[model samples]
Target: MRNLIFLFFIVLAISVTSCRKDFSTIPSFGQLEFSRDTVYLDTVFTNIGSATYNLKVYNRSNKDITIPTIGLERGNSSNYRLNVDGIPGKTFDNIDILARDSIFIFVETTVDVTSVPDPLYTDRILFDNGTNQQDVDLVTLVQDATFIFPGRDPISMEIDQLTLDGEPTAIQGRFLEDSELIFTNARPYVVYGYAAVPANKTLVIDAGARIHFHDNSGLIIDRDASLKVNGTLNEKVVFEGDRLEHVFSNVPGQWGTIWMREGSKENEIHHAEIKNAIIGVLVDATTSSTPTLTLKNTQVYNHSNFGILGRGTSILGENVVVGSAGEASFAGTVGGSYDFTHSTFANYWNNGIRALPAVLVNNFFTFTNDQGQEVIEPRDLTQANFINCIIDGNNNVEFIPDRVDGATFNFNVSNSMIKFNDINGSFTGVAELDFTDTNLYQNITLNGFADFRNTSANDFIIGQASDAIGLGDPTAAAQVPMDILGVIRTLNPDLGAYQHISF
Candidate 1:
């Protein structure tokens, strides 16, 4: 037994010695290859952490190599953090790699505005030491802007409360000040929480203004408040997520919606682009006789839920485009007055299976009341008119009218291209259910092939061979003389928002 133990100890010692020989001690100069010389980390707002970016350090030589040190040039005081071979640290020592093998160097940053000299923060990743030292540039464009987040009490950090749907909810938000009412294009605005426009106030976004919201953050227009976006053709206002990386450009559900709450009025959005949100614009309650919202030459795309959700509200949209939503691209819910002219509502959502249609009109909603009983609310759909529009999607049926009896459901879809087939008998287009009558749905083509410029990439521009071309009412063209692109429309204009521009 003693002899066997001695032999086992000797074998273990030899194994440990052999394992140590895997790395080479030979010093190398200018032989290390990298996947990228300059790693561009994602752009981040002030004091916000960025996503981790990786760099591959390859050992191309035949022999194994040992990197004595791997660190940031800023040393311990650096804002950037590095991770080498799964070990998180600001600096790593004695990192070894086999021949033709590679190791990953992950880097992340969370910089404060006071730490950097300028908004463009730059650093270097130093590898090795002495005469053979090498480095790779690390650049991050840090943006400094006005951050509107939920303000809390300094002592207890207690958030404010807002009444939502008759329920008092704790929210991280505050009403806008007079100074903050006008958002400019000087710097990007980053919102951490809901930014509310109080009653009797108007928040105006200037041309070329870019507003980025963090997850679940959005703009809220309160009762009697207004939100007017003054964007132009050349410089459109952009509302999207805070992530500035290319990978996150079309990602859905990155943020919340521009919520126009009950009694909110006179909201106008023109030449604006809103994307990657759960719900693009949610307009609730039409308290006044005037239209609650007016959308012109605007795009609300890449939403997880409805692009435009109007709950008993009045909306007038022209030359608008709503694209790629998991639910209906435009949902006139619980009855509303909706008018869309020369607009395109297309949902080619390929990310997941979509069960709903692109355009949904409903006159009622069923919900449970506080008494624990199911309650149904009947809302009168005053009007839902679509003129010279394209309501199409990848699905066979892209339009659905969910109307309950007893409620007034009045709608007209004239000279439009719609995708609706009643093969399943779900919507038979009988009486008040759908707009199938010739008088109500006049000159409309049902399930016509759109032949769009590119459906996959969310381009709804119609081709020359499309059935929508030259189908617009000549009288309608005279009403709205220009298209979304500011192009003059002919007297007998093409259908949809773009007027069939040449590809």
Candidate 2:
């Protein structure tokens, strides 16, 4: 009887283990997926302004998912509304999605903004699909609704009660006893004509400050004075025009300019966005050598002439994007030197960058137009070293060296990528020591004199197992210390900005 009881217990244990294994093979309900990671707003608006965006819903499980309703709500407020057609924050219902299928839900909202009171603000929109919800934030700011009158010094305007739709708004301004001025507002304002910075005085601008310009209006810093514009990433300080639309309108010389006059030093500008101007940042000849002009994470876009014109010396940090409308993007004339790293030069009608014979440019990416047959012409560039840079252009657009009447231009490029659709007519003037990797598709058509003694076509490194692989000058600067990307510097660096170590 005891043996029979023990055998019965062993069979029961085995049965229990078998049942647990069968239940583990079963699948769960479903998973949710979204369309985008983040949304960005390019301009600021007020009062019944609306923008539309779409959210894609994906069903990842085998079972069907039912979206009963879709709506939006403010994260801070209990007020929730359905996102529907024609109405802001209107919701749609009865949307059935099959397994491995997706659908798009549109979201639109009208925000009430006022210019007489505070100018800039931000808010978040919470998107809920019955069971799950996601949040997206939006930013808005008031714009200057007025134009400037040209030909005026110290342009002045009266501060009466500025109202927004008959509402008492917050308007603040203060003039110090020593002729120093301070202006603060929640709404947008404009500056007309040429505004001059007084001598021996400092101008301090807070973050999220938006200053607009009337036609031909800009700021000029005279000798013995300084301007400090300190802004944050989220709350960046912008200097632009007073236009309703933020599109490029070819408004040449219509915005303000910042001129650092002679004898002026120690001017610092950080985290600023300067746009829609004629000349963005002008460092005059009188700028003292001790006070280096520093620009960090700054963007100068949609300008007419040079983006950042420096007649003196300057130091630009990483991640600088400069774009032009129809002319040269950057021109450094008169004894200018630039130490730029991880910067971009894009979208210009004329030359992308032109450094006078006295200037030096290092570690930059330059993009020129293919339609325009114009080449970047600098005068007397002494030592222009391109390290891990990218020069992109079309076949028609050629790379023309600076025209030195008597002196020679010394251009040394290492671990770089210079691409042109038409290599036949690309690059003019003879180079002293041209270390080019022959990975260019039209390398046979390239026209120029190069020091081929220390270079080899086998040294040109290609992206992959292409014919131009292993062709470049082994003695290039990028090969010595390696580049920002970790690839062993070879005797021949790759043809473009990036070097491929392994497949």
Q: What lDDT does the true structure give each of the candidates? A: 0.87, 0.47
Expressed as tens digits, the lDDT of each residue in 1-503 for candidate 2 is 99999999999999988655332111212255766644343343333233445556677776665655444444323122334333344444544566677776554333444424454544444444433655555444544332222322224333322232345444221111233333233545466554556667777767777777766557766567777777666677788775534343345456757777665567777667787687888776543445446665566666666677766444443334455433444554543445443333433333244322111232222336688654443333343443433333222332333333443334444433343333453343334223343322222223222111111111112245432234344544333334324345455554332354443
Residue 178's lDDT within candidate 1 is: 90
Clashes of each: 2, 33
Question: In candidate 1, where is summed lDDT lowest over 10 consecutive residues?
Answer: 152-161
lDDT of 1: 0.87
Runs of candidate 2 with Cα error greater than 4 angstroms are 1-189, 246-254, 348-389, 393-416, 419-429, 436-503
Candidate 2 TM-score over all chains jointly: 0.46
Model 1, range 304-324, lDDT digits (tens) per residue?
A: 988999999999999999999
* Per-residue error (Å), model 2, residue 447: 15
> TM-score for all predictions?
0.90, 0.46
